[model samples]
Target: MQIRDLPYTDPGDPDVRSGPRFLIWLGRNQIRGQLKSLSWGLLHQCSIAGLPLVIGFAVQAVVDRSGNRLALSGGLIAVLGVLIAVGDTMLHRTAITNWITAAARVQQLLARKTAELGSALTRQVAAGEVVAVSTGDVEKIGWFVEALSRFAAAAVALVIICVGLVVYLPSLGVLVALAMPVLALGVLPFLPRATRRADFQREKAGKATELASDTVAGLRVLRGIGGEELFLGRYRRASQEVRKAAVRSAQMWSLISAIQVLLPGVLLISLVTYGAALARDGKIDVGQLVTVYSAATLLLFPLRHVEEIAMAYSFSRPSAQRAVRVLSLSRVARPSTVDAAPTGDLYDPATGLMAPEGLFTAVVCGDPDEAGRLADRLGGHAQPAVSQEGAVEEGATDHEVPSVLLGGVPLDELELDAARTAVLVQDKDPVLLSGTLRELLDVPSSGRVTAEDALSAAQCDDVLNALAQASVDSGGDPMDTRITERGRSLSGGQRQRLALARSLVTDPEALVLDEPTSAVDSHTEARVAAGIKALRKNRTTVAFASSPLLLDLADRVALVHRGTVVAVGTHRELLRGEPRYRAVVTRETDDEIPAPAPPGKDEAIHAIDTIEEIEERA
Candidate 1:
């Protein structure tokens, strides 16, 4: 495929069985490109190898002083030169095309897998590892694929040179032929050591990369906790380990490179030395000696490719394995193999937490992990790691956490598109892509809610105003304002509000929000809860939170403890009756500082006059 025609019309299904198998699959999918590259590479290498023969003829013609010999030799030289130029140019063109196309294909596959897995990807694979695989690993895979075709052509050329030498100068040919194989095979023993070191280097590098990614993502938190230096030290140690591994790997490969050069040099010396003797004995003429010597020199070119191909494979093997690891991850929770979205109640058999249709339900789980897992199952995303037996603890009163049921049908049974559209789950740490506000809010919508309505309902007026003020353009419109990645430029409260607004815009049948208002103030939290209740009117909305304001707004509040819902009642009833519920939900409020005494009459008059002056100035 041409570079411009990239992203293949049909990238074809990739084989995720194994790393090597996946590489083979990539090759098979691009067989036509590979063949074209191979043919061009063969012609190019063969043309170079044929050069010695042409030069030999030219040398013989000069020696003979025969009629029109110079002209004939000159014509032959021109023709060979043309073939050499054309072959080299086309070979390079095709090789590059193959490399780019292969990389593009791998990148496309990675992107598709990322989209399919969604947030589950980071849970299954390290964020740094995923970043490394999608970026650096892709290039390594493509490098190997491009090199394989050229290696094949080089092998063919090496054989042709060996055969030609033996046919024309039998004595010298035998030595050179045997020596060529030795030159190619001599480095095989060192390869294992090199490959092992490379693997070590890659492992260390991945860890270091992951550490760096985590450090950057949590820089603000680290600073807040005065742990920035601690994380920096950890990253420094990781980087140092990676450096040591890379040096060791380089040392091994350097030895192999030395061997590659040394063996080929020895072979060249042998051919020259032996060919001289044959010429002296008249068994081979001077021209034949020149041809054999020149062919030996040319053979070095292809011999280098042997080392190159070995190195490419060594590096790419691990990279391909990393890519395969990511691609092989399939959602363990299969929907009920059905195509339609089920209706009615959303039930988690394992936790026995049921949110009946058309109600705003709040689940308060002390353990965040348990709460997150329950949210996943409620959204039909429980991974297979939660074993069937783990569905409900053995002998527990709760029913087995089999596939959650939406209405009466298994949630996992519905088609992915239908199921995803039917139920939307907003994670606690939602991402805001780098784009205009309009694009950020433009999600699959039922057209029942507009962006303005969603934003207002989510108590995002201040967020919109903040974004508008941050806009580079003079229009200062939030819809036109650009948000930085993950909304890093925005405050924590602003990002949370914006995420809620985006979720509201989707207008799904049911929405599951995890700690949707944890970052907002008490007043904003209450407003958001009330807004959500009003907007989602008569639709199922489950908010996993322990905030009193949010829980108070829920039509029904469920207390989840030790992985199961222990109690269910109205927010006020739960607070009055359930001590655990009151303690968990009111813990934040209890820590809050008491209100200060009201200002004195003189101070109040001064504050009022100051406010009036400020209003007049505005």
Candidate 2:
């Protein structure tokens, strides 16, 4: 594949069984590319090997005073030089192509897996490990795969040189052949130890990487809790552990490298000594002695490749394993045998909460985890089934498979794409991907709700103005302003509002929002609730929240206690009748019911508020 064909048209199905198997699969997929690399590599090495023989013949011609033979040898030398130059150039080109294609293929697989696994990917694999696998691991894997063809070509060239030497001069050839194998095999005994050290080092490095990534992601929280130094010290120790492991791995590899060099030098020295004695005994000519010495020295080139291939394998094996582990994650929502998304009440039997059609329902859960899980299920992202043994391995949690149904059909049984299109679940901590404000809110483009409408409903005018001021394009609409990754440059409330606006633009048939207004001020939250309720009139909208203002605006509110909906009523009715419901919605403990702050003398005590005024206008 050429550079232009990168991001492969078809990366082909990968073999995720084992690291070695995956590497083999990569080779098999690019057989033509591998052949091209192999052919060029062989031509290059063959020309190099032939050079010594040509030079030896030229020397003999000079010694015998044969000018015609000398001219012929010179012509041959020129041809060999051209051949070497072209062969080496083409070999490098093909090798690079193979490397790029291999890396691209692996990266594509990783991207696909990340999309398939979605938010649950971090639960299955550390975010840092995923980053490491996609970046560093991909290159290592590609390097080893690309090295295979050249290593094989070198081995073939070595064999050809040995066979030719044996035919031309048996005594020296036998010595060199036996010694070459010994040189290649010399490092084998040390490889297992080196590989073990390398694996240990890689494992420690992954841990360090994970720690660093977690620390960076939570830096704001760490600073807030005055734990920056604690995490920094933790990361420092982790980084040191990684360094020590790497040093140990390097020591083992250094020993192997030394052996690779030492054994080849010893072989060359022994061959030179043996060939010199033969020349002294008149069994070999001066030219033949020179040829033997040159060939033995040239043999060192291919010998080094053996060590390289081994080293490549040692480093890439663990990387491949990590990639395979991530690729092997089973998606919670598979393309089902059934192809339709059911219509009607979204029911989660596990939570005993049912959100019916064309209504604004609010679910209040004391435990946020239960609320999040319920929200996930309502949107057809069911947790995977865990058997008794699996549950034990995963830790103590309810192993029962959550049953969620849309209309009457089980959500998991419906096709994944259809389910997603029908239901949208905005998480409590929704992410705003880096892009222009317009692009961020252009998700799926349901065409029922426009960007302006959604932004207004989500109370994002301040956010839009702030982003506009941050934009490089001063004259453009505020919606054209760019948001940084995860909207990090924006305040927490701004990010939350922007994410809510994006979700609003999607306008799914069933919208499940979890704490969509938690970060905003009370007035903003009240406006958001009123606006959403008005815009989503005659549509299904289930919001999980505890704020009284948000719950007060819902058509119906359900109090979820210990993972089950225990009370369902109008917000006011539930507030007055149910003490647990009142406690949760008001965020009050039994020991304290704090008195409302006294209004200033100038403030008017109106019977109704701004939220009511907005509702009256709507």
Candidate 3:
């Protein structure tokens, strides 16, 4: 984005500067939209310049007191007032629009970056910091951009006023001009202190926000364990720190504000003292003396923005810094140096795994987290960690996948849309967006598949019935019923079922599902397992699950331990041959009791419960 075109808000950026490069980075990210906003904003600032000038000219004319000239000055004064008012309104509106859009664009960029980074993002940065950047920091960066435009217009106006006063009033103007910079910039001395305090306040604020988000996200578990008050107390202490920081910040601002008022006030008095002395000595005209003071008085208005710009920059710098951290993350694997997409089955040579063309497969991972990470790598949600040496591991790649071949081409090598069409990872905790049944299921872009078919496959006939019942109770069609945020309105099983159903409707060629049946009761899960197996018979489906029922249905299963596929076989074959695999999959014995204490079993810390517990009459 050539930010130069949007002169007012667009801070002119050097090619590479740590502090301001971030703003330029944003510009490059959304060059076209910002270029348009910049074009409109400069026009706005140009209009704003008229405000101070009009005031200066009007005061000058009043001091002159000539009949025709006075009337002409009066008319100019009226026009100037109208122009400043109109300009302020329009310029502010345009600049604000640019600010909002820029923030939104940056948000989108961060989201896309997060998606690309996927599991790597968690490893690279704190989850809270990521949340803070996306939610709070992006807007501050946008604010700084918007402030740039306003400061530019005010700076120009200040310069024009000083030059005009010098031209019109000579020596008196000299004193006024000299005083203008000193007064306008007098707030600088207090800035360092203010910035430090403001930064402290912002840090406290971010910590508070992160704490609150964590508390809310884990509210269910927190309440269960009686940890609510502990977090609440921590938050309270953090808030108190924030309050203290805020008071310190406000104190420093009060000092800066005082200087803003006092420095110029001092200058105005000094200018009047000198101008009045000259007038008394008949060295300067009374009218000129009056004009000088008036101009000096007008100086205060523009100076306010100088202070404003400084403060805005103070807040935005840290925000920009945070945003920069997020934007700086590059995909580990770079796309191949070729335009043509590959044509063949996707082969993870490390694991001797081939996602053969258009076929359903199941990955029975022992570790759920490892399973999730592997799914991300396979579906192109993550750039594979590069490892080139004597040793290599499964599901890791140093190069981007080719795009054209669907799975044949690396998903990352293809254009975003093409890759997404070929592979869709339905997260185990599929987010059920708050909406009606119809809108939730309606994947508008590809409407080829019907809701009935997807619902059948997902075994969501019961979910639809429940929704319809809820709707009827609430006086609306079940299809139009509202789903609450996080789908708290629905049970875990219901939400998962709905999410699964929604994914089924899209029917992408490669569908990666993680523990898709973990929430639903075994009976419902059995139906879903059977249904998904039948419906996704031809499509390339990889179900990341350890459920015995789901495992039985898969053509084959890979037992992933740590980050590698340690075992893969039919259920019975693995059970009979792989000792570790059998222990993990069938820990429950004939009586449903887990294996009796194996001495030196420090690794199995968790108490494994099974049908044996119930059978023992406990």
Weakest 10 consecutive residues of candidate 2 by summed lDDT: 387-396
Q: Considering TM-score, which of the candidate structures 1 and 2 is the better prediction for this target? A: 2
**Model 2 regions lying over 4 Å from their true place:** 333-335, 385-400, 590-618
Alpha-carbon local distance difference test for all models: 0.84, 0.83, 0.69
Better structure of 1 and 3 per lDDT:
1
TM-score of each: 0.90, 0.91, 0.81
**Candidate 2 per-residue lDDT over residues 1-618, each given as its tens digit:** 787878887788788778898899999998999999999999999999998898889888888999999999999999999999999999999999999989999999999877655666675577999988999899999999889999999999999999988988898888888887888899999999999999999888888888998898888889899999999999999989999999999999999999988888888878887788888999898888778788888998888889889999999999999988887665543346668766788788887888888899999998898888788778865465222123321422455465577787776666667778778899899988988887787778569899889989989888877877777875657778777778889889999888888888888888999999989888899899998998888888999998878988898999999987899998876765577876776666876543443666223323332435423322
Per-residue accuracy of model 3 over 1-618 as CA lDDT, tens digit each: 323443334332223234477776655655555444444444444444444444545555667655666676667667756665666676676667667766766676677777656666656666778888897788888887776666666677678778887897789777777887787778888899899988888888888888887788778779889999999999999889999999999999988998788888788778878888898998976666766676677667767879988998888888877776666664544554434434445545344455555555677665677777677666666554332221212454544443223544556566555566667788877787787788898883356567787788778777777777778445756778877777777878888988888888887777789889989876787789888878776667778876666776777777777666788777655654565665566654445534544676534423323333322322
* lDDT tens digits, residue span 87-134, model 1: 889988888888899999999988877766676777768899999998
User: Candidate 2 vs candidate 3: which has greater TM-score?
Assistant: 2
Q: Output the number of the TM-score-best candidate.
A: 2
State candidate 2's TM-score. 0.91
